[model samples]
Target: MPMDSVMGRARALWEGLAQVPVSFAPPGGVDVVVSPRSGLCPDGWVGVVALGGSAIVTAPSDGIAVLVRDALRRLPVEAVTDGALVRQVLPVARVLGPAALSYVSPAGFRAVEAGASSVERLSAAHPDMRRLERSAGYEDAGEAALDEITSPAFVVREHDRVIAAAGYRAWPGRTAHISVLTAPEARGRGLARVTGSLAVAHALAVGMLPQWRARRPDSLRVAAALGFEEMGFQLSVEVEGLSPDFSDAG
Candidate 1:
């Protein structure tokens, strides 16, 4: 996978979340591709394009920096309530739940998306699903993927169950990060393999390529099986706190 592909997927991931009605989604900020497209911001935006990474991006005539300036100008997070956590905390802003699990699907992977339809499929037999059941992320959430799978043109299921899982964050363009584990019982049965293939197919159908992180050979095999090529090693760049640069970031 080329870096561009990974970054594009990252943008798609964030955009997908942001596209929902503010009243129906998480409180995270939108994805921004900035620049010098050069030095990255240490703080991550939409899980793509870390501010200070060594990407060596050349600022084009319409470099991402301009887009950042324009977007921030319009959003004016300053005008919005200054919540330390999410981008907007104003009483007027739509209240959304904290999010867990991020995954992307190929444009037409409806079959894969469909596979996760039944939350019940996650029964006691599924290992990953079972683990998810215990996770702080999904406690009582009741099949988080149920909503995402049902919504967004895509769907992700745990084995046959629809478990909302966030994954495969393609930081800047195409490489994605996936860290979802199903109930311990669901492991080894190859549910993730099937679902991941579906996602890769869907992404490819729409020209959004997919790739597996080479670090984990097993996971990489899943991607490779779905036509995903290795793109070399990957690095994780997260934006947790407000970097000093954005004392105004709050």
Candidate 2:
């Protein structure tokens, strides 16, 4: 996708995370989106842009009809209510678990600078990796994913122990998705935010947009504090079991 298109997609994703009603008019048509804070599809709603495409929506039956109509512009559109909307729309879409999408522009990110006296670049060989592996707030897969990262990774330490770490995985176009983990005992100390800021700074320095996805409210709060705008929430469900992806009554 073109850079503008890529940015637009990122913006839409962030708007979804914000869980607010939105109307986006792109080239050919407009997308009427909504992210209901509660009830069905608690994650969010995304409308299909094509004339005969499918949209993944999470709303009451009545609201679904209005959103679908506005989004498809009277075109034949399929409304899928399942949480696994990504997998339904794009078979190749990876299951990323429950997450909220957020993003920060370079200019906006300048306001969230953090200072970490002992932050250091991380590598597979870093001894702190062992501590991160054992931390309850982190997962082995997250540590392993570090190997595939094309952007920067950092860790904050207190003496000899790792307190928090932040990193990003390269994504399509000029965006990089960020991930951060803080030791359970290190919570509320701002280690995650400080380390995360370092990672964001490095990403912006390299001309990459920073994208934040998190399922936890605390994580989302930190992202918001760092100038990341909430776009939407992402939820996934099993694809093998379901009926026709439409419901007028919800």
Candidate 3:
């Protein structure tokens, strides 16, 4: 029921963001928190003011709009719902539980510190990274660009090709978190494990904490194996559609 409502909100948000840029470019925007929805929205959702794509409901706010705000709070990326009735409305997506916001300190963040990295370091990206990309559904964090302002990125390569990657993003007082994804065609090759470990371990070494998502069972395992402790849990709520307002012109 919650998923259904979030699905509807997602559709609505997508419609709102239809003309806006949700995903940030390497050199784009100031930070992840731009104020189209306002407050706490940036920490969870990864897109711009226009709401599109999938979302997670982290908390059950007093109002339904809070679902959208909560979805933007997830570290593991999810669609947490407040109740079953929420889902009854959307009917397109479902509640995928919540993600634990597990983190490792920079002292223990040692995944990438292990060996020679085949991952290329680029400021902006070339078309090659897209080829290395497996799924078009999820977006990627440009480590090369993030490195310019945040943490560095390392990846695995095959046949001189960069196939997988992992890196971190900073949030003011903290050096913050990391993300890793493998090319779908290149699954089961230990690339995610390797990249994940390196990314978290390095974060620990730098006095920064390594916080990744424990959304799926495998996510918990991979992050835990790298010394990331389970910080707790994060809830997500997705809205398939909502009546997004856009009448202001200030």
Candidate 4:
């Protein structure tokens, strides 16, 4: 698909996720909305997603909405998604992320040509997939989001052990949320890029928009190398004393 079309789909996805009736923020500006839905975060927190040239903040209540709006009013759109800036502006009890949000168009994706020769594609339900996750442990496995994938797993094995793997989950707007994990011992071997390439190829074949949400430098670099453009950021902040007001939530 064309880059513009991909971008339009992305906007719609975020709008639906935000549960707002507006386009994303304008250049250098922020748009705040209040609803019961928590966009990208858990309940009683703020979810901020910045895309294109604008940013959107979803709050659980009108009161929290005002707090976010007032706090972010003077900042540029870019700063709105900055975790540190956001934490400083509000009474943040915790922050989930300020992860890099990237997407690739079929026309822009640069597929890896030969390195993934040893990869094997299997059902996500395959038990070895979970074994790989266990091997990677909590942090690496969670960051890869391997547990959430709904697509076929592309894996690399060593002595019958799954050492690296990648896949994606179907998301709204026909988007594919890509996930990749490489065992600690398998690091620095480019296994991630290889397995990830296979998974991305599968998503593109099925006409899904591939998205890479990464917080680590290595993961970000892998996305960039695979032709994904970093267009935005996603930050979820937990505010002190914030509680859901279901009376007006939608």
- Candidate 4's TM-score reads 0.94
Q: Give the lDDT ranking, best first.
A: 4, 2, 3, 1
Per-candidate TM-scores read 0.35, 0.59, 0.52, 0.94
Residue 239 error for model 4, in Å?
1.2
Give lDDT for model 4.
0.84
Q: What lDDT score goes with residue 56 in model 2?
A: 35
Off by over 4 Å in 1: 1-181, 213-215, 236-250
List lDDT for all candidates, in order: 0.34, 0.56, 0.44, 0.84
Best by lDDT: 4
User: Which lDDT tens digits does candidate 1 get at residues 1-250?
Assistant: 4445454454444334332211111222322333222222222232221111111111112333333334334443322112223233211122222222223345313233334334222322335544455652563324223222211222245455544333333333443333333444455555555555544554455454443433344544544445443322212222333232332322
lDDT of 2 by residue, 1-250 (tens): 2435445767554345335554344433334444345222323333222211223333323445453444335432332222343344432222344565677787677444455457788774465765665774346336335445665568877768877777788776567778777778778988777878888888888888888877668988889888887654444332222222335424
Candidates 1 and 3, the one with greater TM-score: 3
Can you rank all candidates by TM-score, best first? 4, 2, 3, 1
Spell out the clash pairs found in candidate 2: 14-230, 14-231, 15-231, 16-231, 16-232, 17-231, 17-232, 18-230, 18-231
List, in order, the clash count of every candidate structure.
Answer: 46, 9, 58, 0
Candidate 3, residues 78-161, lDDT tens digits: the string is: 232223433443332434334455555444444534355455543314455555553423343332223332555567777777
In candidate 2 the C-alpha lDDT for residue 82 amounts to: 26
